[model samples]
Target: MAEVATGTTMAERRASVDLTDRRALLACQPDDPAVLAEAHRLKETALLDFGVRDSVVTSWLYAKCHHHIPTTAVETAAVVATGDGGCLLLYNPQFFVDIGLAGVRFVLFHEARHLMHRHLYVEPELRADPVFHLAAEVSINHVAMVRLASGGLPTRAVPDGTGGTVREPVGVDPHEIHRRYAEDLSGQGRKPLSYQDFVDTDLVVYRELKRMHTPLVLPIGLCIHADHVGGDIGELPTDGETVGRIVGEVLAEAIRAALRGNRIARDEVLNLVDRSEGGGDRLTRMWGTLGAVALRGETPRTRRVQWWKRWLADTLASKLREGERLVYPKKQGAVLLALGHDPMLSRRGRERTKVVLVALDTSGSMSNEVVDWITSLVGQTDGVESHWLSFDGVVMPFVPGERVYGGGGTNFQNVVDYAEGRLTIDGEPFEVQPDAVIMVTDGYAPRVSPAQPDRWIWLITDGGDDWPEHHNPPMACHRVITGER
Candidate 1:
């Protein structure tokens, strides 16, 4: 029953969260100690089956910590907590009756999500609604629909320990169970049922003699990918139009909750929000890159910009210094793929070759989010000429795999100095100069650099300070305000 300290760093908090009470989740059953132990083991197997994360499972367990499970098979299942501790749930037996083992597992996880995440805390009366029980029913029926659609189920029923026939559980195929579970919640079956129907069925089971499953959307392929890829794929892919709609609906609900002045944390909303709102692909790429970077640094936002610029710079520098040429590797792919090409020329060869140089400023004012993201982008690609420049008083192109160090000053002139000998953008044979230069900074640096007649400069910053009008000539600059300032 040890809880994590609230103010610790994210890494520390994550480690603590992962170590949450497995025994507590097991403490729910009032059965014999052996049976309860078996239940705890079964829950672990179920979490694995459902591809739930330790953090998420821990959170669930903590929420469920306050309430004990129903004592008997015939007793009505009800959630007993409120505000931060509340959840609306019911144990339905039909899912268990109809779909078998998967039904039981699906409901358990679904109900756990409600109690553990405190989904029922949103309202006061939901716990009393018959619909509470239906949560699991709809969830498992959805599983049935999906399983039935994608060929067929393998084991419909298993042996009841007592020679009596017990329903085969749905938990065995949690991924598939979640998928169909979502479909059922969406009311996609032949005789369509409302959300109320799903809930009411659970009520009937509680009132009558019967069944199991949790109600929640399991977007198609998500369960498969989550189970295989782990819960941290960053962003979930849009699974066609149907699943996309469900994701959208889920996002809308989250937003509505936020707008209602709920105290839900921003990151939690972000975690649950639709992956497509901003740039899903961009966010995923950025997250993957950040995850690779070391945890020490500034926050996510600052590190993202810094890392992106660094990636652009280092990658560009590596490609250029090696004498590699950027080319269209294949017309099918949209991005330019730089490759080492022969400098030897035929009569038909063109004399001019384009090169790109990128520079990033890592200053005390910059955030960690930007830095980590930049590092990640650097790691994902090849053949691009990238240069990472960290400046306070001076600018230097970053070496591959080097830790960035800078404090208190920045000067663009070093960029000019660094490129002085080898590369001249003006078609000078003296050196192979960059065709374009990209500069990333917080605009806290000296603005002017020595003149380069043919260089293109793209500047990205927070835009607090004005650009010096006396900047070097023959330079066309694009200024990007990242909104951080």
Candidate 2:
């Protein structure tokens, strides 16, 4: 190995970062408070105008990047997402003044979209390709125009090589890109996609352009993420591989907030969440960890022909309903996003598996069909623990389809006593405080209060007495209805 002699060693290189760069890193904002306040105002306006969900995320991305100290470090507003998730927005005040109000909106949205694209699509194959960066600009600029209601391409102030900056059109218009592709495709006599179909997703732009004979011609200026060949001087990621993981954590927190009824966060998750979530495990598994509030089909589904299923699903759902307890869902939600689950309910995470007890009244001819329904219902749902019991005068712990010898007498106290943990089966104490206790009986037993009356649910068979309903402090009582459901 040849040792090339340079005056500066590694130590000198480490210490030799420019004073201007040092000042920029200090992150001190000794600027006009009024102007800084306007920056916040611009963000709020963008959020309101960008709809609820997107605004929540855009706001979140810029939440910490508030070191608005005026510097000519870059021409426009730029967010530097560090190796960690932390990012700071640095904008040159004069550059902003040159671009005007509309351009400020453009810059803010454009930068945010860059972070979003980086976060949601971080497969190594996509990131390694240079074309991905150009395709991203096309998508973000098009979306910005539509979202900001800016009729055409939004412009930005670029350093004019003088003491100040000059306003210039920011990104390559998708319309113009489409037109170029149109000409090339026409020359080859191949059909081109309509503008609507062409610009649907970022990857769409990448794919269509790859087929074209002429290379994509991008503009020169400040694009926050593009490399040096594109002549982009804005902040670039030192390592892009971490963008997905760091931003993934942020996305999960946003989803949790959305689940907790943050409207903006919800809307944002819909737009910002990945459409092709092709991972192995389904997201519902993780969402089930959030307990009842995160259950699916709780919210009204789109109007469809299978309306009866909603009723059936809801009926089955009630058996697994959560008890009076709150839980905050944390990493399970991140896993949910990775597994591709959208926020379905409005509740924080709770600590406990959803416990469902189905006590079959073996004293009479019980509905084997009804028992099958219960078994299938619990099977379909995630995060549910099933505890089965069969009782006549005595309680016996049994599996759902297990045959039991009953028909002796109906003493409902036996089941209630077992559920409240006062009694045991096979000489072992059943100590689990179930979130839901379902008793399927012919309604002939003397009604007794379980330890948690509110947690009890009575499912009376046909020609059976629903005595528990008339009891003071009535429990959740429903009928099996004895039909081929």
**TM-score of every model?**
0.25, 0.40
Model 1 per-residue lDDT tens digits across residues 47-142: 455542223443454445443332222121223332232332222232233343443354454445445334334332432233332333344444
| RMSD (CA, Å), each prediction | 19.5, 20.3
TM-score leader: 2
- lDDT, candidate 1, equals 0.40
What is the C-alpha local distance difference test score of each model? 0.40, 0.60
Tens-digit lDDT string for candidate 2 (239-291):
34455566655665565445434678777665543352344344433333222
Scanning candidate 2 in windows of ten residues, the lowest lDDT window is 1-10
Q: What's the true lDDT of residue 10 in model 1? A: 18
What is the Cα-based lDDT of residue 374 in candidate 1?
49
